[model samples]
Target chain A: MARADVLPLPQRRAIWRVMARRYAHLPLLAPAVAVSVAVFWACMAVLVVMSVYPFLAAGTPRFTLDAWQRFLVDPFYWGVVGTTLRIGVVVTALSLLIGYPTAYAMSKIRRPGWALACYVVLFAPILVSVVVRTYGWLLLLSQTGAVNYVLRTLGLIGQPIPLIFNTTGIIIAMVHILLPFAVFPILSVVGQLTSDLKEAAMDLGANRWQTFRRVTLPLTLPGVVAAAQIVFTLTISAFVTPFLMGGGKVQILSGLIYRDMEAVNLAFASTVALILLALAMAILAASNVLVRRSYSRAEVLRT
Target chain B: MTLVGADRVEDDVELREVSKRFGPVLAVDRVSLQVRRGEFFSLLGPSGCGKTTTLRIIGGLEYPTAGEVVLRGQVVTDVPPYRRATNMVFQHLALFPHLAVFENIAFGLRLRGLPSDVIARKVDDVLQLVDLPGFGTREIHQLSGGQKQRVAIARALVNEPAVLLLDEPLGALDLKLRLQMQAELKALQHRVGTTFLYVTHDQGEALTMSDRIAVMNQGRIEQVGTSQEIYARPQTRFVAAFIGEANFLEGRIAASAPDGVLVSVDGLQVRVAGDGSLPVGAPVTVSIRPEHVKLGAAAAGAANRWDGRVQDMTFMGAVVRATVALASGIAVVAEIQNDAAVGLAPGDAVVAGWAPQHTVVLAR
Candidate 1:
């Protein structure tokens, strides 16, 4: 007899019920996990194999490290990698400087109608096509565009400045596109903060600046780190904004990938793609350390 | 340049005709009170009664719309909370979750630009004072409820301000922990001798911990006195009802005597202790405590006595509360020791009475 048959019928059913409750979430998680493993992981495996093998000739497959070596040793590719990281860092920093204040102001808005309006304004841009938004930036930031026209009318500039077809245009457009990502995480954390903490700090004889530095900023660092990670990865991996705004002037990693793929250089494109993935993983790992450190104190671990 | 009666060095905090209006609602009406140095003063009221608002006004967290806030003999009505010499233990404690216990207590000192060694020493001292000596390195989330309460108190007390404002810091703890913290807080205040301005809606807490309590209702102070005075001789109906349980009997003054006055409630003349100043035929409400109502032979020789039948009885832990209906059909609850009420049950004949002094008369 089976072990389950040794027990009464009700007891056997109760054991099955306990097991169903234990692993109930597995069924709910099936679709997402299935898609991730099938689409994402399977594609990643193909990308890894493609990066190692330069060409697929008829009968026998030939594998070589020449693409990796050539990409790693080249100064031009390294510069492209550096530019990608630099733009990512600058965009993330600028977004935080602008997003923190916006999130703070939104948190302070008491009227629900006004708050909803603010949210609409902040997130509505996300619904628009990224290409259309980049085109809008192009029209505004061009030499004879509205921005230059306004500056010239105010005599702020004697001549039109080069705003497009460069890193500056890419950054401006990318920051605009990715701003909501930065604000959303920080807004959630800021909204959860009670005013009592600020009051407690002031009551302890700390001024406004001191309180912000010692209490407010430290408590919200996890949100800031999360925003930085999201903005950094999105900025680095961005393709269309950089392709349109850079106008072929800025050669970032993604741009290099696009260039190689356009020339049918599949091996080199796969190498660039893997390098970008590695960079993102490194930054995410660093951010995870920061998030864990900040959360270790803020969250209750056990009784 | 000090105004008369306004600058009192003995008073750690004084509010003169302070009022706070939140839009259409008057959160705190024209309220005035004084908190003496080294005394535990409490503002006791139900929620939305403006006790916390009044405390905040004194702490400089809220500005009074029409009056002066004098702290340590200085008119600081417009002074910001950071500039004022007061610290508050918030209702939720509000300890910084990002910092360890030591850093939390040292926040004020560090802001003052104290030396690192001094800050550390002071933090350690306060940690020990709050009975958490080695908890300096512990994160706030690691603490139990009682420990967190102590940490919050320590964080405020370390500043050594002119006064410490506590806004129901013990409101979140369980009953047993709350009672323990109450005793610990009272003893801590006694040891430190810092003037404390406490706000709580718990009457028992206010009575046990406060040297004086200001009973508030509907944005106004009904009365301010010691626990004994506030409990024994409540000046208003709100106070008599809010502070503790009371039996209210509404009636008209029937007659007056040198000893006391008699208030007739539905033709039942209940004698009350007073100077007989109330005119006869005037309306009044008589307040009596259930414990003061004696039943059975214990009602003998009382100034005001009534023969009644037991209508209902409830068994409390140490006492039995028996509701007695008088011959006139008026019901009054009588509390007796468990042993004394053992033989009593519903439908039993009983005499309910109380002394004249035990009856409090309030004008209706």
Candidate 2:
């Protein structure tokens, strides 16, 4: 309190002042926010409406569980689910096994700009059309292809292995495409770790192998889970890789949906698409739960 | 990496004329120093003064370009950090994120293929020593900052290196925490009685913790002495200015007496007694600590007296400092107790003086 009610102008500290919020300008964003909510509701309504359609025949849509029942009872439909799950699991595991070290190397690279350039080159193939990227793999994994040629030259095999136009080809191509997504998440994760932590461990008494197994691997698990989630979901919903590389030999849920739609069976196609969506969500939900449990455990041990 | 316990007291590590060049810059000039068994030594200086570089050289994190680093009299110039008998606590602490505190502390033991039981025992011992006993199973993120620092110290100390190097270990903590950790660290060092080579730019830290501090400047050590010696009688201007606050007055010897010299500054003579390598008529600078200067109407109470105008007075907690200008136009700062005093306005006349022997003479 002061005689003039001045109060000494209460210390104008740099950190004490709160930044003024932009609430004064909120009216400008009101339309966009409203539109976004409306669009989201519209899409949900459409998905539900399409899911309940009884037939591909036009006119009024009717509610029915016939397509859902068909999907549940058919052994082939369940096999597609199994195949999708298998591919997703294999791709995620392979990415982790191969991607962890790749991400590790990328993070440790002395010349990061040059390493980033290399990463860009490695990531270039992921950006190309899936059909083209799959075809490129097809050309490589084919019987008399470049892979066989190089292997033969190196004396690894007497002849080409039966690889292309099968699940093997589909998996190979899908992994190549999905690897970048996995690698990016993990590389960013590994980048966050200071190499000093590893050095500290080594100085404490850990050797090279133990340091990797104990410190490096566990520290980068969040990146691994994030990468797994992205790669698994992307691989599960992949239609082009299986279409181009599977050559009809590997009829995944996406490909089956495509075929059903081509045969004018919109209801069956939608049903298959819905099941694919559900399976992907289930896998993601399970993986998320696993990650959370491990994360909390890691967190607990850290303290 | 064999310097330990009883053997460490017998000159464990030696750097002989060791120098390092980073590109065109000489990060560490040719400098030779030795670590005695169970002695605590510090390389103290400001940032880029090469104290950390020298510590890194000793740690084998950075190799010397010229001289050899001898460990237990055996040259370890080519040896790596892990192969040396030393562990360093980095400024950042660098605790492993994913590992439990126990596992992080036990990491080194596990690498040597120790049984899990042994590792568990060693980790427990270190945790107990650091006062975070039974905290081995906690996650790194869950630990508070101070606990994390303790974990880092425990992690490094568990290896029982003959020489433990700490690079500004207390830098990350707040002021109060830093002050508390300083005593604990010093006590820990005394208990272990190993050769501790610590690096710090903080003058207070170096003076408080080190048995002998090697004051460094521009990639070279200016002086190595105990804190009392470094503070009471610094050999160089840099050490005097860096260690504590001082008022430097440029002068020249006007007359040489039996046991002192009459220094002429501006137009008046200041009776300064010093034992330094400076000749009569040689340009010199007198460094007098601020606290030694007395202020008031001490017109006849000092060897030298000057009438000065009180320019400003700042009341810092615990101490009050006044800027006074001599009649001959030389300004000197004096610090006094900050308790409520009979104050004078800024333009008031004042007399300031100091005893003869309180001044230190520097040639360059």
Candidate 3:
């Protein structure tokens, strides 16, 4: 009775076959993803080994805490980290403030072609070498350079103030170099926003400022966080701009790492590089969390 | 009681020969129209017909290339939307994603620099008016499409703008939601009695909601009159064909007189009356609505009649449509409702006729 009511063997076999077919894409996907993940984990393992290994001299294989101790105990190393972080934080904040309005103005252009032209101008400096831009800033900010020449002509200053080869020059150079990277992501995010919300708010009796505070600012926050993360991480890791502009007087972690590498202090340099990487990763993670929160909130609003 | 003014100072809108051009495209041609105080007026047209553009010009979102915009008979061409006493409910609704329902509704009041207490009270009153009183705490995403639309209305209305403009506000909704909103919006307009300028491509929406309809085409107003007038006596061929279902008979005028004109299409000749002012031998198109065409008529008050064979019968739940082939071999369709008892089947011989008064005359 049960056999008569049951399905045929071919039908049962076909059902089994369909179940097996569910994972047909697995084999084709296995190699490339597996290899890439393996490569990533392998690289991480090498960095971990180098950081924990002892001995400051390069080309020596030894296990020691000497390098870590030297990094933590030295005030100079701490100063480099502090300066790099300070600059990175300031640059990221300014970029967000400046980026939002530029993006808003760009989005308001009636023609898409003109908007694209604005983007090119905003993004062109990024294509130029950071070293070259830094050199340009170096010449401009020099005591006897164009900056002083202009300032003196305006009678703003009687004597040429210290400008290039200092902390101020390094900050200015770093900002110019990182401004595009900071702006583009935010502009893309803002460009996705429709003017409808702003217009609707204004129509509802909201003033221009109120519309921005209530709608424009909150919606573009995810982009702001993303831009901040990129700017922060990139600024901390920047070696060339600071090296050229800081002129040994203002030292950041990347410059210290460079000096350590040249001195063949491989273990010390590795330790510093590892610390820089970890700090950057932490900042990136925090920024990512902020962005995720805003995005989810936006999703909640959208739904 | 806090007394500001008996009527909100900012509740009026007008456009005087306003024109807007985007490079080569004249989006909204020199369109000049008036919305009476507390009248629900609609600008009706198809896509790219400049209805929305005209509304935007009135809202101060788009500046007219020429002419002036007056609100309450005062020139406000330079006034920004934020400074005007008019609010817009966007086609997309454009509700604030960051704010909850209450905040969105109260945004306008807040912008006027009103005290928080007054804003909260006004928002509450409007939210209740829209039947979403307790749902003020709900986020925009949490609300249904209809609910979002209601909130958008509440936000616009709370500020008590003299004029309220809706730019296809229910266009994004599904059919059921759109119908529900139509009734809701009609009720809302009557309740507030603010000068309302509505833009829509949906003729049904305009007919159902507007006190008056302005039929627009190519940035110019083809006709402006009451919905009934516009529907019944369409001034142009575009209005009749666009506003409702009308079969166009492209023909040449065989005879033209002060009282009437005979239009010959293919081999069938139709006498079009009440058509304004035409010369003899001029080309003209005659338009007749399907329902208005008489089938097997005895006394439909029709002055003209034609004998033809029934070629096809289409069942439309409320009405049955039959196509009749005249001796001239030209087919004309006549619609009779199921309840109207169109008993004739295909291949049956019948006489199709219509009244001269019901017949409208239009140009090519």
Best-fitting candidate, measured by lDDT? 1
Q: In model 3, where do residues sit more than 4 Å from their true spots?
A: A1-53, A56-77, A97-129, A153-155, A207-209, A261-271, A286-295, A299-303, B1-12, B247-287, B297-301, B325-331, B339-343
lDDT of 2 by residue, B315-358 (tens): 88888888988887789988877652257557888888887888
TM-scores for chain A over all candidates:
0.94, 0.82, 0.84
- Tens digit of lDDT per residue, candidate 3, span B160-189? 887888899988999998998899889988
- Candidates in order have lDDT scores of 0.90, 0.80, 0.82
Question: Which regions of candidate 1 deviate over 4 angstroms?
Answer: A1-17, A57-60, A299-303, B1-7, B342-345
True contacts kept of each: 0.87, 0.54, 0.83
TM-score of chain A of 2: 0.82
Ranking by DockQ: 1, 3, 2
Count residue pairs with overlapping backbones in model 3. Answer: 5
Question: Candidate 1 has what TM-score?
Answer: 0.94
DockQ of 3: 0.56
Interface RMSD of 1: 2.0
Score candidate 1 by DockQ.
0.63
